[model samples]
Target: MRIVDVCAFYTPHGGGVRTYVEQKLRIGPQLGHEIVILAPGDEDGVVERGPNARIVTLKSPRFPLDRKYGYFASAEQLHGALDALAPDFVEATSPWRSAGLVADWAGAAPRSLVMHADPLSAFAYRWFGQVFSRRTIDWQFSVYWEHLRRHSRRFDHVVCANSDLSRRLAEGGVPRTVTLPMGVEPGRFSPLNRDPALRARLLAACDLPESASLLLGCGRLSPEKRWPMVIDAVNAAGQQSPIGLVMFGEGRERRTILKHIAGNPHVRLFEPERDRETFARILASPDGLIHGCEAETYCMAAAEARASGTPVIVPDGGGAADHAGDGAGMTYAACDPAAAARAIATVLRSPRRQPQEARTITQHFAELFALYEDTRARVRMAA
Candidate 1:
């Protein structure tokens, strides 16, 4: 089958969505499918060419907030690209402008709407947290809900990477919602990858001795990620014993995170590790991975942490909690810094979970590919 993914959130310097798309490109061919991606770029043309997979860049304008990202302007160009690809199936991976365009597509192949992020919790709560109650913010988010609810009807399937988002969309009246968890490369990140030297260096960077409990935080340093809350929790936990935190990742919250961790020798912010093996070793070395986001869809960071045999500390809701798994880590009340601190202390006091082998990426690929086939078959039968 030939599958085309229209992703507005993919860029050379983007986050999880970019990684997900790239991973799909690598796996699609192994599953005997051709995968093409249509993404926004400064230059309009095919940048990556391969027999089974390729990325087609559509000329678009730079996003004002961050020039690293591009915004789609002409829907006609997108439609033209889709028409040319003539894929067996189409998947719209973002809820922004591209989604509406893909939903209204009058094409031969079936379409699927992949919900990669939650707009209400990721954006609204982060944007209006100071001005309105969550209930009020959620009420305002209904506008977005209605937008998706209407567009989702046009697609053959609505797919979510976690059950939380799937249940929310299903409850909100979106049809054919499905939960499909993403997978991690267990070989890249395992307990055996743990490096005592790297752990020592990380501890030293945070100005802590080897005796101090080292907590690792990974992901975008954005407001929705709630890194500040994690920093506060670490500081609170520091009062009890020697605890240090090293956060990896960059985002709009860099300055804010720096300010939050200022004057605390035990907390430091570091740029994301580019080397995969080194990063996995870092994950394996940490006493635990602490996550603050409650609106997470499928936290690849937490999943990778678990794959590295590192225990995770996450909020009690959202995808992170689901990835933490029973006996894999600890969970605190959602968005509660105090509770998170206690959870951190508990994890440090308790013996670490024995590193277990993680399911391979092939498993996730097979499951998602089956969904595509099933959707296509159902569409043909209905036709």
Candidate 2:
């Protein structure tokens, strides 16, 4: 079976969606399927091709609305590409302009749309007022949601990354909404592969002493991620433990966060690690991962951290709770810095029970890949 993944952004440009597509492409061939990715061109250049999958670049001019490193592709160009590929199945990550082209190319083949984030999540930054005004954010979300509601109807299957997204789709009257948790590459993230020297070097480079308990928060440094909360939690926790906070990822909120932590000696921010190896190294070295984001389809960083035998301390609500798993980590009420701080401290002082269990429980990704294989088989039968 041949599967074409349509998304407005791809690897080296996008986040979880990009990684998810790339993982599918890597593993699909082993399950007897070919995968192709279609995404917009960025300053970084077109995606580098690989054996299991080929990346097709669709050029689009940069615009103001393309704020979050996302771009809109021309429908005509996308249709031409799909018509040429004639894939057995089409999987779209977003129901944006690119998704419209996928809908247009629906010909007899089965198509699926994977919803990684709720359209309303884009509006989450409005409250912070550092990125976009409330009015502008509202308008952006309204437009995106309206497009998703209409275009999503055309897909044979619609997958939501979590139950919240599934509920949102259900409310919008979308048919065939299935909740599929995102999977992590355990091979890359396992604790057994941790490089202690690399971890020590990263800590030293970040000006953190080996004795300091490091708390990591990995994700786009955006207002929605609520990074300030993590900083505050670390500050509060510093009273108890010698805590150093290191955050990975770059975004519009970098300057704001930098300014917020100007006088704080305990916090350090670094550019997002593009290489998976570096990311896994940081995950394994961190004492615990902190996540304050109110909305997350699936907390890829938290999952990776847990998979690396690092406990995750996430907020109570959101998709992350589902991924944290029972006994894998601690989940506190949203934005409670004290709770977040306490959770981190507790995890650091406690025995290695949770991290050990995390390694055992996170093998669910194998089950998820089985589902992906099954989906491909069904598509082949229909084809």
Candidate closest to the true structure, highest TM-score: 1
- The most accurate candidate by lDDT is 1
- TM-score (C-alpha, index-matched) for candidate 2: 0.81
Clashing pairs in 1: none
Off by over 4 Å in 2: 42-52, 67-73, 124-146, 193-212, 274-278, 354-383
Candidate 1 total steric clashes: 0
List, residue by residue over 1-383, the lDDT tens digit for candidate 1: 89999988898886998888888888889899898988999998885656799999999999898888887788888888889889999999888789999977778898888888887777777678778997787677778878888999888788888888888788878888888888896368788888888888888988888888899999998888999999999889989998889889998889988888877878878889998878888989989999999889989889999888888999887789887776889999877899999999998998977856686667887888898898889879988
Model 2 lDDT vs. the true structure? 0.71
lDDT of each: 0.86, 0.71
Please, what are the lDDT tens digits per residue for candidate 2 over residues 125-218?
4354467774566555666657776787887678766776687667666777877676577567877756767665656755667887777888
- Give the per-residue Cα lDDT of candidate 1 at 363: 81
